[model samples]
Target: MELLERLFMGSPALWGGGVAHSVLILALVVALGIMLGKIRVAGVSLGVTGILFVGIAFGWYGMNVDGHLLHFLKEFGLILFVYSIGLQVGPGFFSSFRKGGVTLNKVAVLAVLLGVGTTVALYCLTGLPMTTLVGVMSGAVTNTPGLGAAQQAFSDLHAGAEAPDIATGYAVAYPLGVVGAILTLAALRYLLRVDTQREEREAGSGTDALKDLTTRRISVEVCNPAIEGMSIAQLRELALREFVISRICRAGGEPELAGADTKLHGGDRVLVVAAPRDIEALVALMGREAADTPLMRDRKMISRRILITKSELNGKQLADLKVRSTCGVTITRINRAGIDLVAAGSLQLQIGDRVTVVGPELSVAHAERLFGNSLRRLDHPNLIPIFIGIALGVVLGSISFWIPGVPQPVKLGLAGGPLVVAILIGRYGPHYKLVTYTTMSANLMLREVGIALFLAGVGLGAGEDFIPTLLAGGYVWIAYGAAITVVPLLLAGLWGRLRYKLNYYTLIGVLSGASTNPPALAYCSEQTQTDAPSVGYATVYPLSMFLRVLAAQLLILMFG
Candidate 1:
């Protein structure tokens, strides 16, 4: 019994209380939580959030660890998680906001307002303390930053007596907040009788530009006399689409790699690499269908995935770079993040974009040099921008703005500041000579590690008193918290779907974003088997998070 206790709790007599003990407890909690989280019931899983419950359990068992270390890990983990998310969505964030983003954000704001209204109603009905109600509000949304902001506001207002209630209410309500959002998503799916495959097909059909990016190789014979003497560049201009002429073979001549300036003849057979949808257009403009010949099999021609690591190339359009005219290479496609983009002349290059360039071996090599395709450089983390972003976020979080009729000023807080800053850096950093690109593996690693640390810390900190609080009158707040969590989500989510005709996947994402629940977003993504939910989540996240924090404080000030 003593040995088991010492192993789980660490003995002061043997391995004195320090970082090692803290690390040991954290590792155990995270490992167990991850394994436990994978246990699915009705096709739903808690994911990494299982770590928090495990931490709470350990803390409930009277396990002691370093307090300061736990605090540091918790905050640092949150910073890492939000910052990584910011970087991941940063490139598309602005563009996303421009397209149907305004309406989605408005829906998200309505959801936030609905949630705040629910919390206020719960407070009035239950006669709960304002601090406890605010905590429940934060937990209902699964937003730690909101809770922190509320606590900060409480402290600023000298309502320290209600502070303990905040944490207790938060702990009791948090688990269900995570579960409730997922449940709301599930309920909507069933209620709406949503067909997942049909939704995917519908969404897919709507994105024509993305669908048109599929690379296809087609051969055409130059039967048109007008196009016979035209250069490849002139033909490309006439076609009015982004396709590449890779090789040309004239009567009684061997196939040779084609360049933008290469001239065509009446009998020439040309191999064009372009989207399948654009093939008919090109064929109509250029010539008739020709026999399939292995034109691309030229020994001197090569195709390589060139990574854009050079800052100078970042944010510059392909037309500006003129790789086709300058290096005689054709960029068939560009892979950004995980999305494949057809390499159009107007397509702007971002750092870390992998462009598939095809041309003569010499030309391809020159394009590679221009792009700085350095595998070693990609492995090194760009620490300067990361730290600078975090520093700026902290400063931004610390500043407060006074509001009319409010007792305390509202601040962006840690999560909001870093998130907002990272989004800007991800979108505009390239313009300012800052490389905000990170490899997928690195970004995922940082995000996972950060969330894990954060969950562990929260669980450990709240665990010690979790059970006691729950058993002693804190238990009722769970029901109150659940009400706060589900009411707003269901109301707003259903409204968006029924009125706005939002796609089920996108609606789920909007609910998750409005709630600021990562677990819900993860579940929605898994259920839909698409990243579409992520788009909705990312688009509304910054604004939702800010509103949540502000609303939490407003709740405290109004009712306290």
Candidate 2:
């Protein structure tokens, strides 16, 4: 029993070691939480949120952890999480505001307003403390940033008495917030009698404009007499589609690399790289398809996906880079934000863009170095922009704007300030010579680590008092939070479906975005077996995150 307690609880001797036992406990909670999170019930999982539950259990068992250490880890984890998200979605954030973006954002904003209204109503009906309601509001929306922002606001207002209540309410409400969003999706499907197949078809067709570029390479014989004498540039203009003529082979000569000004001759074969649908038009304009000849299948030539990781290469035009002239490699296509774009001369390269370069193997290898294709480099976190962003966020969070008749000035707080700054940096970092890209593995690691630390901190802080509060009418906060989670989502989803005629998949995405619930988004994507939910989710996520944080802080300012 003594050994078991020492192993599980960590004795004072363990605590007095160079590394405190608290650190060990925190590590255990995080590792166990991650493993437990992978266990799904009916296709639903808590994901990284399991860390909170683990921490709660440990805290409830009287685990003594360092409070300052927990606080630092929590806030730092939150910064890393939000900053990574901002970078991941930054490039597309502004573009998502265009076209149907206004409508999508409006609907998303309305949904957030509905949640705030629901919170207010619950407050009036239950007479719950404002701090608890604010926490519930954050949890109900499944937005950890909002919760962090609200806590920051509480701290700013010197309301230390209610701080623990915020964590307690949030921890209690968060699980239902995730489940409630999924349930809202299910309820809407049943209530609206949506046809899954029909919705999928409509969503696919209606959102065709949102489709990523699909590229294909084909060899076409230039038998068309009219275009035979035309330059490669002229043929490209005539085709009226985006494609590149990478190489040309004459009737009895070697397959020579082709440039824009290279002239096409009748019976000559050309290698064309273009969008799948556009390939047909080019084929018809060029001539019949041909099998790969010996020259066309040159053994020395190769293709490789090279990541653009160097800060020096970012924001430079493809023509300016002169890889073909210097390294003998041609960039056929560029993959950015899950879309394939033709490597036009004028197209600028951004950090994280993967360019498919085709050339001699040695030349491609050289090009890889020029493009900074070091996996180790990607693994090393770029600390410059991260620390800069956090410093700026803290500064921004301190600035307050006074409004007439308001008791307190409105500030962006730690969460909002850093999030907004990260998004802007992510979008325009390349333009300003800032490298904001992180490898996918690194980004996910940072995000998971951050959320785990944050959740663990919150759980440890709330656990000691959680049981007593729950026994003393704290359970009502859970019911109130559930209502806050479901009512707004269902109302907005149904209204969007019936009135605006939104596709079911899209509506689900909007609900997920408005709630800022990644778990719900994951479920929606899995359930639909399509990426349609992602478009809607990405479209509203930035605005939804901003609004959620603002609303949480506002709720506290109004009712605290």
Predicted model with the maximum TM-score: 2
Q: Give lDDT per model, in order.
A: 0.78, 0.80
Residue-wise lDDT of candidate 1 within 1-560, one digit each (tens)?
Answer: 98877777777776776677789899999999999889987756667768878888988887757878877787788788878877887876665454366667777999999888888787778888888888888877888767666665665567433265676677678778888888878998888898989988654443322223235677898888888689988987887887877678888887776777899988889887776567788898777888755575567677889999887888888888877777888777777655455677777789999998878888999998989998787888888889999999888877888778876666666666787788889988977778899888899998889889877886877787777777888888888888888888888877887777777777788789899898898888887665667767776776787678678767776676
Instruction: Name the TM-score of candidate 1.
Output: 0.74
Candidate with best lDDT: 2
Measured against the true structure, the TM-scores of the candidates, in listed sequence, are: 0.74, 0.78
What ranges in model 1 sit over 4 Å off?
1-20, 144-171, 193-198, 207-306, 315-317, 329-348, 355-369, 373-375, 516-531, 549-560
Output the lDDT of residue 510, model 1.
76
Model 2, range 294-383, lDDT digits (tens) per residue? 446777677789998887998888889888788887788987765466787887788888999888888999999999977776777787
Cα displacement (angstroms), candidate 2, residue 356, comes to 5.9
